[model samples]
Target: MFTSPFQDYVIDAAQRTVLFWDVMRARGNQYVEHTAQDAPHVLSYDFEPVMAGTDLPSPVNYGLVRIEPPKGVKVDEAKRPFVIIDPRAGHGPGIGGFKADSEIGVAMNAGHPCYFVGFLPDPVPGQTIEDIMKAEVAFIEKVAELHPDASGKPTIVGNCQAGWAAMMLASYRPDLCGPIIVAGSPLSYWAGVHGKNPMRYTGGLLGGTWLTALTGDLGAGKFDGAWLVSNFEGMNPANTHWSKKYNVYKNVDTESERFLGFEKWWSGHILLNAEEMQWIVDNLFVGNRLPTAEVETTDGVRLDFRNIRSPIICFCSHGDDITPPQQALGWILDLYADVQDIRACGQTIVYAVHPSVGHLGIFVSGGVAKKEHREFASNIDLIDCLPPGLYEAVLTEKTEDTPDADLVATDYIARFETRTLEDIRALGTNSEEDERRFATAARVSDVNKGLYQTFAQPWVKTLITEEQADLMMKIHPARLEYTMFSDKNPVMGVVKSMAKIVRSNRKPVERDNPFLVAQEQMSDMIIRSLDNYRDMRDNAIEALFLSIYANPLLQATVGLSADEKPPRARPGRSPEHIELVKRKVEDLKARISHGGVREACIRAMIYIGQPDSAADERRFEFIRSLRKGVPGELEAFKLTVREQFFMLLIDESAAIAALPDLLKGHADEIEQGIAFVRQVASTGGEPSDAVKERLSEIEKVFNTALCTKR
Candidate 1:
């Protein structure tokens, strides 16, 4: 207390210096270790390759690998297998299962066989995106062959970039896919709102994908993924420059392992072939063609999202700036005219929107994996049972005292609430003006890309060399940051040596230490400043993009018609489609008088239940237990019930009129069915008056049928 301020200042400064040096040494060690481990490929999962894409006729660097189940977990070969495809945007594979609490882990824990679609660091020479898609199809076929006892096709989970890839595969070969979960995947490329998403404007502002071609050419036909990683980091400067490093420094002693482990995956950049990169940019990114069915494979077959027969589940987050809820959910609006159109196409689309979670967090966060993914994995059968329509999978936390809590294995309850196209629009930033602007951008991109390809590509390709390209990649700003502070740098050798001494004689600061508190305040100030700068820069970019692309003159110059509206819906169904739907409806009507008490009861319940409401896990568990007690073939009965329920939803009055035939003379079965319906309806709370009325009406129908039998 009696000490001079200068002495106190000197002591605090010395402690800070020691801590700083130690942090630098730890970072250097991490950098060196990560580099060594990442030189080949970085995958958190321990996997053995089942098949390599190179072994196929159309070779690719991709591979199919089965994930080894964690200790105490056993795979169920009879259960539907899960194939998780991680985003290969910039970082290496395994983010989908980087930890035990991840997508793959959740599937494995649920006793399902799991596989991963990962790629080598180097792209196969002369490989295209089409080849990769083919390889993925082959991988899925192999997995299917391996699990002959599996009840259904493999469930594929696609994260971010891989989400679109999986969709392509599903669209091309619908027979091979089952239920597909596309989380944080942007199908609608140009579908972001102003002020919130600046990345969408990047392609337009940079004048289309010509720059992409140029960059790839300069890289000796290999697009360096570090550039993509840099773009991601640029989106959050505070985290990139301050928070990420400060987190490790502040908790260096305990945080080293976790931080290093994550960085190993984050820093392991991959590569893409020039042709693959250009095709993605030209067809998907700037052109926005995937949802429109304009993208064609090398074999001239078109990719149509409507062709996918598997039930599609889209998992997105409102808080994800990279793939916002609009980008994730807008394709439904674009491809189908309305919810009725979805039903007519016989597609079951389920979507879940988390209130807050980043893009990566959607796939990798432990909390998400536990709640959303666990619920999804456990209730795949329930989802499969749902009628052909749009629905939202809602998850709510289960309280300790909640009814049937002991009977449920998970902590969250899962429910599927029927949703409408309007409900989906509510999740998006649906501005007609924004749509028109993006359409114009797409047109302009076509012009700019053609001009570049015709005039500039050949010259650029001729001047680039392998050695120069490798040097350029090595010196990329993102890679340099890591290399500059590693053992490769002589200046860091002293830091490593000094850090060992500091570690042995560590003098940790207290939480209330004045100097440490002040340091934190300074760090926060820096982060705030960086955030402010980022906001300003993003706003400016947005303003500049609109000023250039929204010009009427530019629209005319790009050959876009002046009075054209955005193409929001797919073209009307052809005559063949109309005839097919009519025939199917006729067939369903003919079969309406076909089943017994179980079918009639399930159909009537689906008819009367409120579409706005959802059933909890307890309800699903009760159903499962009820199924076990029933006297019929379980799987076949379930399928019949689902099909009958779907027919009822399509034509309520016709389906209800035929119910008497279905339940004729089965008085005891009718009573049992009513009790089961009541149990399901009353799981969350008391049944509504509407439900009670519906139950009464169903009872009256059964009574009438019994009297007729008499």
Candidate 2:
């Protein structure tokens, strides 16, 4: 018999409440179990430890582990191994491989040996960031040693906080890394659009990281990572306080396991050394030093991102409020004057901007792994072969009508379109006045930090005992919520029994029940209210931050009034570097017409590719499949491509005219060469009129050279 709507609502509500409490009880139990296990990690795949940082000369909590491929997944040891480093910003390790479909799975599925670089919950006492860097280098070196016959150096994948870390390692030891992928990592901390990114205003509004120092001191010299986790939760108050729990409560039967699993990782907060936190705040966050090459090692070795020799791929999203596209890609503007500077330095940089994906989604989302990351892994060789310039990595979903669909190995087709500095600038950036405000904030941070260290730090350190600090961490709202709902709590025993009885007599409501619909509407209204309040609060914080920091008096006090240049000023290239660029271009100009049919064919391909300013994987794959008539390896082909590309950039007219000179002896094969170039170029689709014109020019050159030889 059908029940009344009101009776169904009462039964469903009662059952949901019991199941929700039971899930919370389960989450607490999992938290307890996870903490009890030594070296706890959330990886779904099994792995064996390779090396610990403690085994190194300078110990850290970090360790390297080799992932064992799952059933039916065969890894090719001859291929370059992949090393994935997860972010240690408040959370414990294994985010990169916590699920079957993740960064680790992508590389492993692609037949590459995979390794993970993760850290323990607690840092080795007195361990610094430099130690972690050194440990990472050692881990990569070990991987290379294990695969002596590998094709190249290990590819490094750094997610979020680890992205900047990967960049640093590549810069410090360029030869140790192959291609570098930095996903959702903020390199330029001060960059953001005015009203859209309220997080950038936080440091300034909080009086410039003084609270960070105070918290560290209160923690008895250790910085509680729960504080960082709290900050992230604070970004979306509705989700933190209401919607997250409400969704689980509403769908308790099916959503409980997933909720508990995610909470296991989320609630496992770690620790950072007070000194380490201070250095990060001083150097990267407030000082904004990494992008400008102002950071150096203890031994005075300058860490310049420009010095990295490998191809760097940046993945960011427009939907990520924490690390927006500006912060992820703005460092390019900070480092180079324009795209010419990038090419002149012999660097290949590619970036992709997702229309909508949150920061964590960039790393852990299964859909992201299947599409973006799979494409990246499959086309890594193409990325390596790309000529030194700025290119945007665009992934188009493959369809039945896609051009050259048979050539695409994956579900998506990847393309690297040539981009310019204007493209990055079009995203968004701060004005000169806005930059001045951030500069003032940085100056104020330094002053405030100094004052805390001198006056407040000593007394706080003396007053907070280790036991007292431990109690404070235990009582932290973020942690307390989990512990309070655990099995250890006497009150949860009743909840567990009640949940079991409800499950035995479960009677779920129909989808169209009036009361259920009304309940959802109420939830929507609550969320809307919370979101609006958040917006207003953020707007007020932003306005207050601008008013205080933009004050001329405060600016003058912080040594900004007399300076006409922006605070985070762009550093110009040195005379020696300029001379080096000139020498390199002159060298390429001298060798404008030097090669065989291979060089002519590559030149033709790149020449036609310029019209559309894009080249897809199909075209690149076709080029790679060409016969090795020339006595050279893949690296040789890459070098030839770069040389010919540079020749074009130096003098396009001369580079084209010299094609006949390259094919001087091979004039008999001119027709075959044209067919080859035309075939490879058409993989993307039918060529434009401009491309046809270029192809016609090449034909004329081939005919003229053939006749002259005859």
Candidate 3:
């Protein structure tokens, strides 16, 4: 093939320039963490050594930093102590509290005492997850002891892997956890969108747990965590290859430091015990037994998620392909038959799903950290104040034009509605077919693990030594940047000197620069190319696996082996308990007939959704007008209504069966309530649609029961 002289010259120049750039970046990555890490004095970070009863338990260290809260945000004396646990999947600690308005910063600004859960770089000779759990409990207990006068319990904020870890701790050690908030944690691991969320199918496609064991063996008994973090990044080829790098290249003047900074942490992954990785994959990914009370600790202690007493708040986003809302909330469907089951378990689980925020947004986004995280920290008590049931989490943005929150130029109040088990299942739309596949994957993993250990174990143990293994962990392409760029290399000094020169000029592209605009467009184009390459690679792998696995006979067998089935209500339970429950339901039903919550809710819905042409456009005026005598009374009313509602749910099997007959008398009242809701809404359209839907569902249930009983 003949090439033009101009084209040949261009290709040669580009190759040389790319090679030089790689050399410089390889050196700069040693100390920077964010892609845009320009040194600013606004934040200071330190990972003070964690005191283990013995030598460093793991290669990880933990520490706390004092954040100087910016002006105007008040610190509340009565707030509970805040402890933020950043995910140690691939990155280093401190991102949870990386900025001044971060989770740690928000907690501190709110005047609550705060703590951080951190780790060292190396694990003890044989550190296990069980040991890590013991250390975290000890740390939290010490914080509680330090703050004897703090109101309520300590609020534990867990980000990503830390989020699931916190949930495990809360389930087993509820006394130690105050209120648990899991940000971007995927509990219902087996569930997700097939096309969009292909990551979860990894174990099945790889022929189960053999790869994990092989990788562990390859790493000489200690599994490299960089591999796992890479899997996370690999899930988003677009983000990892194109967007992330293009973001830095286009905004090179501002993004250079940030890119290096984030890469530093992302590349600085620690290792996990072979047992730890195996268990997480078997019990979490393939088996998905955690939420359904199937996980057992190493010591035979079963981990029952239902044991947790704290009001659980789940923060996830639709844009988070890694941990979609379906994956976050689907556990509810796996665990319970209905909303009543949640209440009966005495659990309050509230979930918030963002319209477009990504998984990391749950933790790293400044807007999220300031608003949702802040509101959660501030009103945790209010959430606890809610009756024992499921609810949605919402956050309303403050606007500039309106003195009142109604007129505030807010995008939308950030509020998440409490969802039902049915509501959760509705998101993923998974049927028995999907559940069976995960079950088969779990069984296959078991068989492969047993076979591998029997045939490959002796050889694997003797073939690789510690030194060879350690080098492999550091040099794994996933961590190539971190291992090569440290200051220990004399070559880094040259790169540092160049960086200093770049920092001196400190010129970013002007908002109006045409060249800058073109550069950004080009960067985006490169990013898209990378993303498409990734998409093609993933599709190819999936297609290959599908062709191998798609046998009607084999799939049927797998389905038969799946553990999912219908739930059974207990037989012949105590009559005394049943009788007492019946009476409470009756009393609560009467209370609701005269109360303000349903009425207030319906009216509020109408006023907000339907704008009235003739009337003043305010949602709470009707409720506010009724607020004169309710000043101290709103709390009293809320408590009374909440208590009665839950009480009815707790004791009303008989009432539930007879609901239609019961609703016969309240039919007029229910309609009146609906009509009142319609009047309060704006005139353009139906305002109280959700509330109406709720009422309609209730009516249908009653109508069905009435038909059968009569």
Candidate 4:
């Protein structure tokens, strides 16, 4: 180990040199590639290219159109067309169909006709965001026209920023949409877990839209999306600076091709017009407008999340730092007082949060795309079928067999429960005062933004030029990796060749190696030091800024902002189909007390419950969301998991009641697990029939075995 330490210093120094040399070599190699492949893919939305001859419908051509069709995707005319809208936040489109186990791939595999919503760098003449939205509507209409036999409407999938954009489109034209599956969207800007995801707070800390206006001016009326991508990478300095590069370097032999492919797309950062960026910041990030119905497009048209009739299925992740569960969900709190308000509006909003997936994984991770996106695509109808309500989606991936032998295999389950506004509220603990304060912030932002535009924008724009604008855009940190590494240059070709050789010759040390262990230890120490600095920096900023901005006196100066509050609940339950669900829960509880597999099964089925007794009061809130064009049969779906579960187990009670405890001696633990199950059931929006049936059978065995003993 002593010799190893001496050897490690030498190796580390050598590695550092190699790393620096590689960067230079890579840059030289990129010069060659960039010169050679500097050509952009001139987009044409007019022609659909066929890579392979297939029986599936011909793909639509977005020409420079921004959309990609899966190579062998086939469509089922009987099902709704699946239109996946790609985010133009920075990178190009096609991530939706980039893999066979993707959102588009799954939709096509399920026999649903699919389409992509893409765009070009240059707008079509005078095209604006509203124009793009109209184009989306047109694409949906075209798909719908093609599938006249489809009983259901097209289910639209939108990822990240596109999710909110798609939601905006749906709100504008509810008739054209079916279900909107929003993956990793930050609809609720202020709704974040403390101590993490402080990016939203950045604008607030930066003193609002001043920088945005300045950046727009600097870009000569165009806000390069590269900056946005850079910001995303900047949030995770470790991942950006070391982990990412190290992962590729350590696994270069395998990672090179994958890295190149991803970087090709990732580096293809797009540009947004100043008008659009300004709107996004002033309204979304700063104003908090969509949920509040206070936004208007440049054309003077109003924006209202409540106007849409479709159901919205929001898919976010707890581990997703970019668009955390709170950001994805907080808009509900921003928009409505309770779920009853949602029901009164006849909307259906369903949200599913993964326990631990990161932001990109939500859309690109094959497992997630296959299971979550696949199930969501398959059961758009079932989700649409759910009665108007707030639902939590819980997916149970079918495994082969457990070591415990208590379960069966080969299943994909979608469990749903009807929820209320209060239940949705229960997810967080933000008080009414906090919300009021946020509202005040929103109003202040509007005034600040308006003042800047009226007084400062013209001078800023005149001072910046188009050439400088283009130069600035090209060099943005986000685009640097791509622009710097292409195969177009001559020098890069030689270095690329050498790099490949070196990569092939590389072999990592053993996990237990002293050097490897020391490397980890040292890297961790650096990371810890950096984290401390980061905490200190962030706390200093927050403390200084809060004293300056988030103030009671300033709030008082803002004035009368509380008058425009979200809708209030109608007090008690309105006696919708809720009573039936309640009765089912009570019955299921009783059935479980009786022993036997059949009885247990009956108990499981009979007890399927609506988690919130207040569901009926909030019916309007969900109904309104559903009507906004979210997919599924909104009126016919079950509201509670208890109801859904009871429906599953009760009928098969007799057969199961005859057997031993299916959960075995873990009956108490199993029974005690009901709280989580109830929560899962409550939030799980809709289950596919396969899952529903499996739960019934499990209950059957559970009922008969446990009942006889009792």
In order of appearance, the predictions have TM-scores of: 0.94, 0.97, 0.74, 0.72
Question: lDDT tens string, model 4, 1-710?
Answer: 34565465455444443544455455435433432442333222222532211111322223222134445654556667787777878766667776677786777777776666665553332345565665666667777777765757778888998898888888878778888899999886766644666666677666677678778789888777778878887777777777666666444435655665455456666677777777788778876666666667666766677766778999988789898887888777766677656754557788887889989889888888778888777667667755556887766654444221122112465556666667655656344554554556666676777787889888877777889888887676665565455454455566656555655554344456667677678777767776676677666755654555547677667773334443221133337535754675567555443443223322343343322322221222223333344343333233342233433434445423422543455455444433333333323245445545655554455444445446
Residue-pair clashes per prediction, in order, are 0, 0, 55, 117
Compared with the true structure, model 3 gives a TM-score of 0.74
For each of the candidates, the C-alpha root-mean-square deviation to the true structure, in angstroms, is: 2.6, 1.7, 9.1, 11.2
Structural RMSD, model 4: 11.2
- Alpha-carbon local distance difference test for all models: 0.81, 0.89, 0.63, 0.61
Q: Which ten residues in a row have the lowest lDDT in candidate 3?
A: 608-617
State candidate 1's TM-score.
0.94
> Which sections of candidate 3 miss by over 4 Å?
1-74, 298-300, 400-418, 485-522, 541-642, 648-710
* Candidate 1 displacement at residue 55 in angstroms: 0.5
Estimate the TM-score for candidate 2.
0.97
Winner on lDDT between 1 and 4 is 1
Query: What tens-digit string does per-residue lDDT give for candidate 3 at 1-710?
Result: 86654544444334433434544455344533432332211133333433442433443234333333456655554557888887767566677877776788767765776677765544555666666766677677776776666666688888888887888878768877777899999888877765667777788878888888888888887788888888888877777766776555444544556665455565556667777777778777776777777667777876777778788888999899788888888777766668776776667888877888987778878888777787777566556545567778756555554334443222433333545676676677455556555666666677778888899977988898889998887567776654465555677676656556555644343445554456567777877787778778777765654554445466555444223352211122246745765786667656443433353343234223322212221333344345444334444544553554453444444323334443454544554544544444532224356545544554456445345545
The per-residue C-alpha lDDT of model 1 at residue 212 equals: 91
lDDT of 1 by residue, 406-434 (tens): 65678877778878899987765647666
For candidate 4, give the lDDT. Answer: 0.61
Error of 4 at 217 (Å): 1.2
Clashing pairs in 1: none
Runs of candidate 4 exceeding 4 Å displacement: 1-74, 124-126, 297-302, 399-410, 447-451, 481-494, 497-508, 560-710
